[model samples]
Target: MSSLENILYFQSALGFLANMVLLLFFIFIILDHRPKPMDLISFQLTFVHIMMFLIGGNSWLADIFESLNIKNDIKCKVTFYSSRVMRGLSICITCLLSVAQAVTISPSTSLLAKFKQKHKKYIINALFYIWILNLSVSSDMMFYVVGFTNVSETKQMQVTKSCSLLPMSSIIRGLNFTLSTSRDVFLVAVMLTTSTYMVNILHRHQRKLKHLHSISHLRASPEKRATQTILLLVLVFVVMYWVDIIISLTSFLLWMYDPVILTIQKFVIYAYPTITPLVKISSDKRIINVLKSLQSKCHQIF
Candidate 1:
């Protein structure tokens, strides 16, 4: 395999394994005791990332289809449509996570506190709506994407080796772009707003804690750490999301993708999902305690 293909496979494999581990950890937590709303959100996010890796893997389903001699058009529609839906879910879930964490860390006296008691129910309902919205919004992919042989050479906008996007009328194209851009912009705006609110709350909280405890005794609280981690994820998502958008727009306007740019785009696209599980594993105290327990057991065996 070429170096490019190798790198793609490496990314897909690494992300798949990391998300799987994170998902298992969440499952352990949920099954062991009452699962928190945060845990549920995280579990869903990890699952989405896993699906993304599986669908987009360099040597996975696409290769399977090729080996089975599936029709190229069927392959294009299935792969592209699935990948697009997962991408939509990734952003929506990330946004939901940010908002949920903000609410999680809100002061009890604050207005957001009321929802805390019912957060799990609200989260479940929100997730249902998000899935329906994204699934419907991305339905256009199935219509516009086709096998390379289905479209004329001049009209083809290649997305993959076998898949190309068929051109649409100007009105349809404009409306599609508007719908997609509006959804992304609204979600990102919500993420930023919630992130700022969380930071303010943390600052006020630290000040109060400072008055009650010595500086050395005031370790980072679990709430603060969780908020910080979610903030970091939001920042990463925003950066990657816009960069992906820019690349997509440039390619759309030119009706062609530069190979190097495409590679970089995929890197940017996968970076957030790849890093999220690692961040959670490192930050969660429960996971750390479990790891320590396992290590002690291993030493005893030796």
Candidate 2:
């Protein structure tokens, strides 16, 4: 493999492993009956990311499918459709994560606080709807993707070595773009609004903490820590998400995909998923404590 290919594979491997570990931790949390409202969301996010890596892993799966004697069109359709669905789910879940955290930290008298007692039900319902929406929104992938044959066709947007996006009519393209852009804009707007609210709450909370005690005596609560971690995640996600969008827009305008640009876009796409698990592992006291306890037990056994 070329250097670029090697690097991309390494990136995919790292992200897949990190997400897997985080998924396991979230599962443990849920099974132990100690899960916070956001735990379920995080678990779903981790799973979606894992799927992202598996489906879009530098088109490695394409080669595997070929080796397995899968038909070209079937493989292309399956791969692209699944990839689009997972990508949609990632953004939706991340947005939901931010909103859920905002509700979680809302003051008891606040409007959002009413949902707190029944937040799990609301979250479950939201997830169901999100799945339905994304599945429908990304349905276009099945129609547009085909097995690449190096046909030198302008209407085909080469996605992987094996899969290309077949062009649609101007009206169809416009409709698809409008729907996609609208969905993304609405989700991102919600994410940012909640994030801003969280910042305000954190700021006011810091003031109260300062009034109550000296800096040395003040410690962050678990809730504060989780909120801060999520804020950081949201910031990272928004940056990466926009970068991906800009690349997509550039690709669309040019009506072509430059290989180098496509590679960079993939890197940007996976950046958030790779960093998310590391950030959560470091910032979450629960995960940290679990790791420490496991280490202690290992030492005693040795």
Candidate 3:
């Protein structure tokens, strides 16, 4: 196996491990409480996105097996479109989370702050709309994505049963690309604006509480803590996402297959789902308590 193949396997295995951990995190969170709408959404996103990655990864591995004289070809529009929908939802959730955190740190007198307070009950409805929008945006994939088939009599160099985009009008492809890129750019812009505001808020908060604070000087209000956690998530996400996007775009533009870039791309894509659960559980006392109790019970059983 070449270096690229080895890296591909490594990336796949890493994603599998991260998915298993996130799966457990979701299970424990659900078991710990009657899952709220947002909780359910997180669970759905984590589970579905990871599964999509696995399916995509398996599709790639099928290509590898074919190269080695094995017969395998599995690719369909459902898997392709499902992944796109889940990815869009993931991006949407991150934007929403950043907005929520920014709202928390906003002065209660602000109109945005007031709106958030008044519409707290409507969060699920808003999220539902987001789901609907993503589904609608990705619906085209169902018709356009088709399983890649062997072009020759003998299988060669088909390391994956990749899907080919169906021939469509240039106008339609351009529109689709524009729409998807706009969605990502818009959310990223939202996150950056809110994140800048949050930094100012945290600075002021820290200054105001400086004298009254304890030894480590790290004691922060719950709102501040939550905002900080979210800021961290957003920062990490932006860095990973943009780097992945840049590499991806460049690779397409240059028609290059650099393994390092490919590995980094997968890692960047996987980073958020891998890190989100840890951040969430750390932020929630209930999750921590449940985790501790479970750990103690496992000890007792062993």
The C-alpha TM-scores of every prediction are 0.92, 0.92, 0.76
lDDT of 2 by residue, 47-161 (tens): 9999999888636766787789988988888887888899899999999999999999999989998999899989989999999988887877597888887647456888777
**TM-score: the better of candidates 1 and 2:** 2
Q: lDDT, candidate 1, residue 301?
A: 100
lDDT of each: 0.85, 0.86, 0.68
lDDT value, residue 273 of candidate 1: 87
Clash count of each predicted structure = 0, 0, 4
The RMSD of every model to the true structure, in order and in angstroms, is: 2.4, 2.2, 5.1
Misplaced by over 4 Å in model 3 are 1-23, 34-41, 59-74, 116-120, 150-161, 167-170, 211-216, 251-264, 278-286, 299-302
lDDT of 3 by residue, 60-172 (tens): 65565568765322235555666778778888888887776666568777767775654445566767898899888887756765565542532222212354444556577
Q: Rank the candidates by lDDT, best first.
A: 2, 1, 3
Error of 2 at 246 (Å): 0.8
> Which 10-residue window in model 1 sums to the lowest lDDT?
149-158
